[model samples]
Target chain A: MSAALFLIALSAVLALGLGVYAGRGREMGLEQWSVGSRGFGAVLVFLLLAGEIYTTFTFLGASGFSYGLGAPAYYILAYGTLAYVISYFILPPVWSYAKKHSLVSQPDFFAAKFDSPALGVLVALVDIVALIPYLVLQFTGLGIIVQIAGYGAISKDVAIIIGALVVTAYVIVSGIRGSALTAIVKDGLIIVVVVFMGIYLPVHYYGGIGAMFATLDHAKPGFLAFPASGQSVSWFVSTVLLTCLGFFMWPHSFAACFSAKNRSVFRKNAILLPIYQLVLLFVFFVGFAAVLQVPGLKGAATNMALLKISVAAFPPWMVGIIGATGVLTALVPGSLIMMSASTLFARNLVGFVRPHASNAQTVMVAKFTVPVVALVAVYFTIQGSSTIVALLLMGYNFVTQLFPALVASLMKRNPVSKQGAFAGIFVGVGTVVFLTLTHQTIGTLIPGLPEMIRDLNVGIIALGLNLIVMVAVSAMTPKTAMLPAE
Target chain B: MKNIRLLAILPFIGMLAGPILHNGVEPYILGMPFILGWVVVWILITSAVMAVIYKYDPANAEGDEP
Candidate 1:
């Protein structure tokens, strides 16, 4: 590598290391590790949330979906931006409530709301399961960027291992604050690179965005039309719902939410998050244009679509900067996932499995668990060749099964049974796994429903079924088995 | 519980209407090529629903107690 390239990598590492050191001690105690000491300001929350939204998939999958799936790929564009306004109001109270209760994970809310540690533990396990593959997705993203950038002396596995190790060290040291500070740089670089590429590539290859679309439309009919290819109207309906409700269920989202310094900060960031997702529109063009320029790369992390473009087009030095940016993007999220997992584990799992554990001990347990989870993710991403879309959906679906009891407590007379929550999650996960295994395109799962409904996203169906079964089983139970829904 | 019911049904009408009235209309907001009008509308309506929830919140007094 050139001196310029080496210097960029060193600075990136140093910037991240400096960030962790700065966050070495926070007076809010465990809240800092789990949720940035619950003091992340408005701008910090916006950047942190944006970092979460724009993961390895935004770069790789959005492009892949556009290149491979056509206009229907716009779901990635629509869902993210919409999440801001939806969450703006929902999150403020949730954050206030979390702070009031000092809640560390989503399951903690469920446990307290429903008055069942068993339910909390079950929810914890579900989040951990969802997070593992999601972490692998990030690691896989890191590997692809490293391999493509030509780390000649360092093999692909070594690059991946090194990246994961660095991320784990920082996360274990400083937690969410570390990730959020780094996000400041990550989002800045991503914006510059995305805008530069979106402008450069379209003009460079096709005359412009108009010409690029025209070529894609001719070559791929119905490219701009709704329900293009295999994405059905039912699928669209289900996906919109899935994104709206389930986006809140992600465990890491709680980590981000709880980090807010105040309720108003949450609302401000929520209203503004759409603008960040709006940036995805530019990144989407990178993918759509790829169809016109270099269309054959499939089975890749959709987030990689951007990095792949950079590596394939720019010279080595520029490619290295973009590569470093991509690594940071993957790194931030990868670390957060493990940190959130460890937080969930110590709070819910150990608290149930070992009731005698103290707060300091729990915090210690969380710090140690980060590298273990990162290694597991690294192992899976390297050994596996599965589709990135499937990897994400599986996590989404599994976590979503917990929605019924969550929403139920907000209203209705139903009491939730621990057995019923378990059944709902297990069945929901199974249904998603079965559907994904038989996926038509990695875009959606949920087979065997009529074509109108089959690709309607398995996660939606899982949530739907989870609610029905939860209500039904709860109805059959005695009052003692139920939580007071109202 | 009635609040949850209202929350479920309220946005649903707009949601159904949205896909029917605006499907395939690419980023067209009142005839402008906004490249993301669906999302823009999505955020607007979602915020509106939350506003409704807030307006009628039963625990408003309790929340303000602190």
Candidate 2:
């Protein structure tokens, strides 16, 4: 009956209830499960996409980076805004294509557009592998939130198992609608918590925002600004560009584009989503406040700075609310991507293997795979918790290689042949994995690289190689005259 | 509207150029340091720019379907 446990129980029950409510009266179809019947309004789509945006990485890791890495953390805010800007151009065409073709997932889009089901299967395989670490990242963050909230009475392992079970059950029963419904509540709590933490913490401890910056400036000069050192300016620019390209490539976000009511909904979201990016500025504020208040937090301990400061400043009940917010941050996105990943596997990959599967059978397979995928993520979370963010970045790197293929299919003509696209993706993702595993600098993979290439993100290097191979191979293939799909 | 796609690059400039131009923490604006302040300004400017494109871009004129 303690405050922490009470708040935890309350939020869990509320989330489950919302999940069940969202599923009521909706027919059980692949379209319903994957795209929420393709009937959601601008507000619903906004909430769903926003739910995917403000994950534990945003709430916890954003602040952690601010405390630990300083100015490099602004890349989070920059990338988000740029993503919305890019979405203005990318998503409308994608939405109309999916609507016209009755596509349900990323691989579905690729399969139909490229007129190659084999490529669809390949895309599905790559995306599902990329998503596993992402799922692990969320569950690991969820366990940390729960354990901290319980004041160490509850262990991280038990919390992670319980969280995985709850999320799997809700997603299996309600699918993406469950995620959208829970997002409304989750975003509401996040707004209040972010505003409170942003303003109150800075003012209470350091007198005001201006004063806090002044003190930090004196203590650690250039900490509030981007360092021209190891984390260089080129790193910032390339990271921002790479993230913007890969943002919507996440299966869940790409699928949410199909759920939009119309093309205008995406345009409106592009205009409105920047307002949401403002929230990260406040989250950054929370991290800056923690820098001096809670010093010397090393390694995994840095991720706890925001929470530790909140517990010290606020009452246990309020701290519990913050804890619940953190849990939802992980749970909502975790449920969503799991649903998307499972549906992708069932529809695209499994369908390729079986060659004859009904829509009803595919839906059943998607539901059945939820717990299997959840348990795999749970295994990874327990084995390797600290590398969650690195895993997420690796996912982004692999997913961004899909960007060129997407652009070719979405915008270009027969300039990119199927063979070219396939080879490009293989080489691009292979380079990323190899460079990452060998711990080689992406820009300096080859000796005597230019400063621009050396300081840039490795993902961008792989993307460049991807585009080059795609174009070169396409030009070598025989030309075929054909009308555009649109 | 044919040129609306060009507006996409505006955010890249606002986000990328700010650090290369004013990476130092001086000339605080509205109580925020210069580099951080540049990001905030661009977020606002990107919204306004996208709003302009949305107004002229005819892709969404088809209206909502039931």
Candidate 3:
């Protein structure tokens, strides 16, 4: 095998070995498997939470986004810092509540908070739908990275299949502990690889980072800043805000909070996480470097921009190292997502059906479902042709629909009834699905709207509809007994 | 003491205002487009602001651990 492919294979074996070893000699109950039995201290919790930030999505999608859309890609950096700020306040209460209630999944938190098992089931369904696309994005990135680094000796389909099997093997056995252990290595490798490529490519190609921007501005005017309309200032502001609200709404991120040993872990992390987000600036530099060097990549093909430029610029061993980092990026997040989705399925959906199912039985069902989730994501990764960023945004639209109800439930009085929360999520998710299926944006839906309002992210409309429905339903429905505040 | 938490809102304002007030390619900040530079600065500002809030917030006071 080539040096690059050999490196990738070696790293894959290393990740599998570390992941399985995390579960060695430990009891594997649902709580232990899903949330590390709520025992993770500051460092492990930090790695796990930060792990969500540097996924294949950031490794590949962020760079590709800058390469394709330029200024709009800055939203990636903007929303995450804002999300960390939001998480500072929100996650402490969430972690405390989860600790008290012994909640493992996002649906478990909602179910206990609202005192409604059906709402939990509804949330599980919505989360599964949202998470599938995200998992598919990781698999798609893995496919592209491995295929490119292997010099195209392997097909993308085969690469995805192998990646899915490896992730499934670890997650089914080791669960969240596996993801946390692998995250340490993934984060270390990605930081080094992203920073090196980000700085090296710019200096090598255009003498300095400043000179690179000067050359880009002269070659493609207005590409580095938002346009007046379409993906405009309005779109940038709205997209950033919407994604910020939705960031922790991803079930894996929500559940990851439950793993923290104490409430202060989140507060401390909130201060540090934004600095971590600055690492994404390096990711954008890599994308910007690719834009001028490897030109003419359009549509979904743009997702390959980072890898393409790497292949053109670096020798086989260096490409292999980058590929190895990419593989771990996908596996770390991919396993977490698969684990979360399966836990939601078995614990929330199936447990609702069989309300008396024992904890061991629930864990068993979850273990069995990991490969099934991997299979479904693999199928979609092969069939879907959307750019990696587009897939994530689509998932964000659906998942963000859950945010209004989530925040409302955390209120001191929780003005929203369980019925209201259910009605709101149903309508919000329904609106997203309807608009997405019809390929209709707010601008297209309501003709003659002003450009500023029209170009706003369409997810905002769904969120607005969710808030309205939740309020109306809450007013009409009798309030359920509120959970006693701490 | 309670009002200290409001410091977190600064990042939202600074980051969201980038496109509206400073969206441009010219006058690059540290070799980045104006909007990109605006975001990078705000990220640093956010970290600093949160650090201050963490220092003063009553929630983090000793013996507050649950």
Q: DockQ (Cα-based) per candidate?
A: 0.22, 0.71, 0.84
Query: Candidate 1 regions off by >4 Å?
Result: A3-8, A25-28, A151-153, A227-229, A301-304, A387-389, A412-422, A437-450, A478-486, B1-66
Tell me the TM-score of chain B in each candidate.
Answer: 0.51, 0.87, 0.90
What is the RMSD, in Å, between candidate 3 and the native fold over all Cα? Answer: 1.2
**Candidate 3 backbone collisions, by pair:** none
Native RMSD of candidate 1 (Å) = 4.3
Model 2, span A1-486: residue lDDT tens: 669867986888788888988898878899999897778899999998878678997898889889988888888888889899888888888888898888999988877777778878888988998899888878878887888877877889999999998899889878788888899999999989998899999999999998988889999998988776457788888888888899999988899878887777888999999988698899999999999999898887788888889878988898899999988898899998899889988998788998789989999998988899998999999997556656677788888888998888776565787778888888898888887777678555676777756787777768888999988888897432343666
Q: Candidate 2 at residue A77, lDDT?
A: 86
True contacts kept of each: 0.13, 0.80, 0.88
Q: Scored by CA lDDT, what does every candidate get? A: 0.68, 0.85, 0.90
Instruction: For candidate 2, give the docking quality class from DockQ.
Output: medium
Supply candidate 3's per-residue lDDT for A444. Answer: 97
Interface RMSD of each: 4.9, 1.8, 1.0
Q: Which candidate do you rate higher for lDDT, 1 or 3?
A: 3
State the lDDT of candidate 1 residue by residue for A204-262, as single tens digits. Answer: 87777766666666677556556633575566666766776667788997667888776
The candidate that achieves the highest DockQ relative to the unseen native structure? 3
- Candidate 3 regions exceeding 4 Å error are A387-391, B62-64
Tens-place lDDT per residue, model 2, B6-64, is 77777788778988876788888678888888889999999999988888776655565
Docking class of 3: high
